[model samples]
Target: MFHVAALGELLIDFTPVGLSNAKNPIFEQNPGGAPANVLALVSKLGKKTAFLGMVGQDQFGLFLKEVLEKNNINVSGLKISEKFQTTLAFVHLDKSGDRTFSFYRNLGADMMLNASDVNYEVIKEAKIFHFGSVSMTEEPVRAASIKAAMFATENGSIISFDPNYRPLLWSSVEEAKKIIGIGVKLADILKVSEEELELITGKIDVAVGADMLFREGVKVVLVTLGKRGCYYKYTGGEGYVDGYAVNAIDTTGAGDAFLGAFLYQICDMKMDELCGLNKNDFKRIIDFSNAAGALATTRTGAIPALPSIDEIHNIRLTR
Candidate 1:
């Protein structure tokens, strides 16, 4: 049985091909989208995983599908839309390898996904259902994603959400906050970045941001702090794990890698076991996830950068 089922966008990212050139800055195509990247990481960790989303009946769509298959992710729930084009994002990375996105989506195929397109049976079979806030930026897809999360919860599946909070994709920051808050309330596990925490709580302190989220019904809150590692907090627990020191090449998928590892660990344990996990157990899980995120930053791209289970184990063993 698949441990996790993720639903959202699967698109192509055009990253700079080489160092910035005066004449023309070439670009390379990479398979991306937060949910899809998480799916890839889960699969890389030797976990049973599936992805449910829509892609266009285009070459880029084919590329995205191939990427999922190559990573051993089940793509049976993937829908192909003939009327719309696949979504695309142009990613620009500064010298520090920090990224900024310029998206080109006009009711793209990914956002065209409707509730009818979802495979409710597959979602019911998974231990956890994971998603992100990007799909909430639009209409039918937003409704569809919320419906899926609700159904997953009703069927006893743990819901994990990442309020990935891209200001560019949203109509306004206030609107994004409102909608994302709804998602956080519905999720059992919530992942946020430092900037996302500040935006969501208007607080610079991570502890305060996590406390606010816990009060709103989020059972667990993970704050990814890039190089500083990640912070994990729950209703009755709190801790910080220092990140591994690595030569970070690109940080595009680090957060997804971290979330994927965390979800996989939770899914591997029985629901009753998870409910009974002690603070020590939670710390170990978050520490392992933090290492996964750090390793991802040492590589390029998103899906291709995720570490395998053996790699994660070896890294931990050495440390």
Candidate 2:
């Protein structure tokens, strides 16, 4: 059985190759999508992982499948749709390596997935079921993802949610908030960035944001603070894991890497160990995740930038 199973989009990221030449900038193709990136990170860390989603029967879809297969993630849940085209995103990185996205996904293949498309057996077998908010922007796929999350919870699987909010994807901010709030209530572990927290709670403080999520029924709340590190709060405990010092080249996939590593670590531990973990244990997990995120920044692309367990250990040792 796989340790984690993720359901959502799988697509191509076209990143600008040269900063100086805007008019004639080269574009490099990379496999991405929050769920796909998480699967890649977990697989790279030597965890058994599977991905469930739909891709178009196009060259881009084939490319995404090949990437996941090469990374050792189970591709059985991936389906190719004939009616819709593959999704594509154009990513532009600023001087600080933070990215701005221009997406072309007008009813893309991924959004076409319905509840009928989900493989219940795969969800039942996994220890953790992870997903993101982008998949909830549309109809049938949104309903399918929510149903999957509910099923996973009922079947004794821990649910992980990352509300990777994109304003342009939803009909309105109010709608996005309502949908993401439902996810927050359903998730056992919820990850959010500073911007996402502000968007959801209209609060800038991590403590306040974490408190709001806890009240929403999330057992664990992770607030990622770019280079400063991550803040975590659970039932009756809360604290921060200081960030690792590194020269980051790109910030893409840092959050995905962090979430994947944290979940993988929890899965690797025994159920008793996981349940018995105290504040120190939580800190250790966050520290490892922070290292994974920081190391990811030193490299360029998203999936390719994720550090292996050895690399994470070495980086931690040296730091």
Candidate 3:
């Protein structure tokens, strides 16, 4: 059985490389999409992972499949679409390594995934099923994602949700809130950025926001605070873990790497044991995840930037 199975977008990210002699920007293609990035890191950590999504029968799509295979992620559920081209996102980065995105996804292949295209057996065999808000922005794919999540939970797989919201992808804030809330209620493990927490809960305080998520049916809430660290709250325990210091050149996949690392560590743990984890147990997990995230930021691409087990261990050792 796969340790993690993720259903969502798998697209090409055109990240900024540098300027040409004519002062025009140059871009490098990278395999990204929050769910895919998370699986890549988990597979890199030697976990069995699978991806369920649609991509165009194009160069970019083929390249993404190859990347997933290289990372050892099973792609039996990945479908090829002849109707639409692969989705593309141009990532703009400031000096601080923070990023903004411009997407080319009008009727993208990823948005065309139908419920029938999903392989329920993958979800049935997975220990955890992961997803994000990106796939919920459109039609067929949106319905497909929900179906997969429901099937997964019914099969006793843990539901992991990440509200990796991009404002440009949504029609309105209200719509985003409404649809994302569905995933919130379905999630057993919810990972959100600090801004996302405030968006969902309308509260600035981490403690209050986390409490609100707990009420929304999330059993665990992980709030990422870039550079500073992360805050986590579960049914019986809560605390913050400081991030690792690094000369970060890009922050594109940092959060995905963090979540991937966290899930990788706990994939084999039973639900009761997971909920029973004390402060020290969480501290070790978060420390390792924080290091993975910090290390991811040190490089330019998502999957390529993910740190190895040795690298993560070295970073953690220094702490």
Candidate 4:
């Protein structure tokens, strides 16, 4: 069975590299999109993964397909759109490597995916099915994402969700909350940044926010606290795992790295085994994930920045 199968956008991220001779920023094209970033890290850890989404029949789209194939992820369900171009996000980073985005997707190819285009076979065969809110920002793809999640759940696949919310993609905060809430309800494992936890639960306290998710029927809640660490609440227990210290150059895909590493460790476990994990068990797992996220930030791009298993271990040893 596939370790993980994800349904979402597969797009390009134009991350600034350096300043041009004219003092303008020079950007580099990086393979991105949250779900794809997660799969890349999982594949790095020797997991079998698949990507299901739409990309334009263009240069960037073709390049993304090649990147996934090279990373050893199954791309058989990745569709090429003739009507729209691939989505693009220009990432602007501050001194601390925190990022903001400017998107070029009014009607991007990823948002064109219809429910009929979903690969039920991929979802059915996956041990864990992952998705994010970016794909839920618009039509067709929104329906496609929901359909895949429901199908995966019905087929006994563990559903993982990350509300990698990008404000530019949403028409209104209320709309985002509504759809993202649906994702939260479907997830057996839900990963969110601290800010996202507040966005979804309307509570500032991490524990309280997690409590709200638990009440919503979510089995696991992972709240990522950049630089500080991660807080997790499972069915039987909860705890916080401190983050590793690293010279972060870009925090673009750090969260994806964290979730991917976390998933990689638990992908093979049964539902009962997952639910039975206590605080100590989660601390060991989240610490490893924290190292992966920290290591990803030491570099610039998303997929290109994912650390090898050795690198992750070395980072953990520093603690």
Give the alpha carbon lDDT tens digit for every residue of 26-86 in model 4.
Answer: 9999999999999999999999999999999999999999999999999988999888999
Instruction: Assess each prediction's global lDDT (C-alpha) against the native.
Output: 0.88, 0.89, 0.94, 0.93
> For residues 232-283, what per-residue lDDT tens digits would candidate 3 score against the true structure?
9886688899998899899999999999999999999977678888878878
Each candidate structure's count of clashing pairs: 0, 0, 0, 0
TM-score result, candidate 4: 0.99
Candidate 3 residue pairs in backbone clash: none
Return whichever of 1 and 4 wins on lDDT: 4
Tens digit of per-residue lDDT, candidate 1, span 1-319: 6899999989998877675558788878999999999988888877889999999999999989999999998989899999999999998888888899999899899999999999888898889999999999998999999999999999889899999988899999889999998888898988999999998889999999889888887888899999898888874478798888888878888999999999878876765576567888778888899889988988778887889888788778766
TM-scores of the models, in the order given: 0.96, 0.96, 0.99, 0.99
Give the RMSD in angstroms, all C-alphas superposed, for model 3: 0.7
RMSD of each: 1.5, 1.6, 0.7, 0.8
For model 3, what is the error of residue 239's alpha carbon versus the real structure, in angstroms, after optimal superposition? 1.6
2 or 3, greater by TM-score? 3
Sort by lDDT, top down from the best: 3, 4, 2, 1
